[model samples]
Target: MDRSSDAPPHPAQALPVPAWQGTWRFTLPPIDSSVPQARHAIRDLLRRRAAPLSAERTHGLMLILSELVTNAVRHAALLTPEIGVEVTVDPHWAWVRVEDGHPYRPHALAASPERQRTGGRGLLLVQATAQEAGGSCGVRATAGGGKVIWAVLPLDRPTGRPATSPPPRSAP
Candidate 1:
């Protein structure tokens, strides 16, 4: 009697995970130069990983990244020796977080046409940008007595494939 008929079939191979479906964290010196460097690094990372974000989404993410890093460098440099940046991109959303040793959790100011201002609008801009893209932004106090400001944007496109828009967002 042939015994080969009793053998089970081989299991199917699993699909390879995407390169961009994970978190990337790094620290940069709290200095003016780090602002542009952080932006370039993020742009390159998205390009290199072939993230599924549209061009406009990528640009907006970069802008949010820039403002966060710039704020850390300008305000937190006195107490923070290094600024930390973390980028997390899953299938549904892209998240950027900036952490600094300073404990201040800066609040985003509401834009007032009556009040003229040049500076102090970074957080406001970040909030507006994230909101426009169906995302949310907020600040949290870290365990080490620092603060982390984060923003997340949904990666849902209007066409081509099924939209996996993020769940309802909470207040920023």
Candidate 2:
């Protein structure tokens, strides 16, 4: 009948490594002008993780993040005061998610003349950029009553063998 005896045994502990490896999450207040800040944060996170990213890839990430955040801001404007954006970067990919109070799923903007007339192209940009980076993008409703528009970029370097020794130099 001893209470201490009824408790489960503690689990074994795992040693921590000196190297840094884990997901980094950031929550930003919904600001009217947060695109720039979002880009900066994503860049910093990627750099800190030592991601093998090039300048072009970095710019792509920034653009995608900006677009996603902007879409969330625009579509979920009414949910902003109580909502925020979350950006996460892991070893293999980076993600940006906007949390709102609404439960609507994000739909890609059509390219019809009427749909295009309104100038709503954020989702299109996200899909194209993600595809260009050898990645994929999509949206899903969260269990907590909101939706997340996310894009994943592969960390692997582009195809093509690394450069070997230069061709034999011509006689000087």
Candidate 3:
């Protein structure tokens, strides 16, 4: 039997999404390996749309997507089937939404050095990244019983972590 046909794709070969301007959505099998693929997909989506992200923001997006997708994979099963990742962008912001097969919860513990060593800092980092980009993080229960955790990042925010968007370019 040809085993190549049965193997999962290498991370770089994970997706070839059509170029889209406003939004791109993906449904990946709920497995651990999907995490990196998800990150690459989002990065490709941003680049294909001609949206330039600061290096800091790029790093933030990778961390947030990895954390969110890893959490969803933990809760996935036959009943769940798939996990959804959505990337949407507008003139001023880029938003990432991950839909999981679980319900939303409001409470989260503050992350500390000790706690982080044990691997519980996902949401803490996510929320911090959102705020750092002049945006917000939120969670809500979907009508179908799953949960969606999202972060909205400002597109115009400075790459150097400055307090405001770059000044508008003056007309030539």
Candidate 4:
């Protein structure tokens, strides 16, 4: 019998799940100080995610987002009046992607005698934070002659000793 051809397809070939299921987008004017704005936007988005994130994780996410936005602003050529930063967060991961209007490919600067003085530490910072949070970072060229710098942070809550309770108060 030729019944094998009529069998249902395997489910293992289905598309993989997205790391971040919820998405938020922001548009900021092309300016030198857009990093701070990006950080604030990320903070607000993280708050909306309703995760019990520690201060260290929150700070790390903000710093990494700011660095990525700053790198895009400084390196990419601006065509439109605004640049966009897209943030995506899910229960297991968070990511920040910055889009600019330049066609340059993002590259990590190698440590060298001459290159070190050019102030190219932003990418390093992003990479470091991502690794620390058990995640990764990368970049890709956009379709409209632009580039996107992205960094992902794992949302895995730390597992170890229980959190310490506040000390007892003495009677007044």
- Top candidate, metric TM-score: 1
| Residues 8-98 of candidate 2: C-alpha lDDT, one tens digit per residue | 6656544443222455556655665676777787688768766667888778878888887776666776765544555544445555555
lDDT for 24 (candidate 1)? 93
lDDT of 1 by residue, 44-73 (tens): 999899888899999989999999999999
TM-score of each: 0.84, 0.70, 0.73, 0.72
lDDT of 4 by residue, 34-152 (tens): 87878876787677656546678788888888887777677763564568888776555566788888777666666767664757877877877877776678777677877777777
Name the 10 consecutive residues with the lowest summed lDDT in model 2. Answer: 163-172
Model 1 whole-model lDDT (C-alpha atoms): 0.86
The lDDT leader among the candidates is: 1
Candidate 4: worst-modelled 10 consecutive residues by lDDT: 163-172
Q: What is the lDDT of residue 119 in candidate 2?
A: 64
Summarize candidate 3's per-residue lDDT along 56-136 as a digit string, tens digits.
Answer: 887787788888888788754444678999987655567788887766553445866666466656788888887776777
For candidate 2, report its TM-score. Answer: 0.70
Q: Model 2 Cα RMSD, Å?
A: 13.4
Score each candidate by Cα lDDT: 0.86, 0.63, 0.72, 0.70
What candidate 2 gets wrong by more than 4 Å, as runs, is: 1-21, 82-84, 87-91, 113-118, 158-172
Give lDDT: candidate 4, residue 35: 79
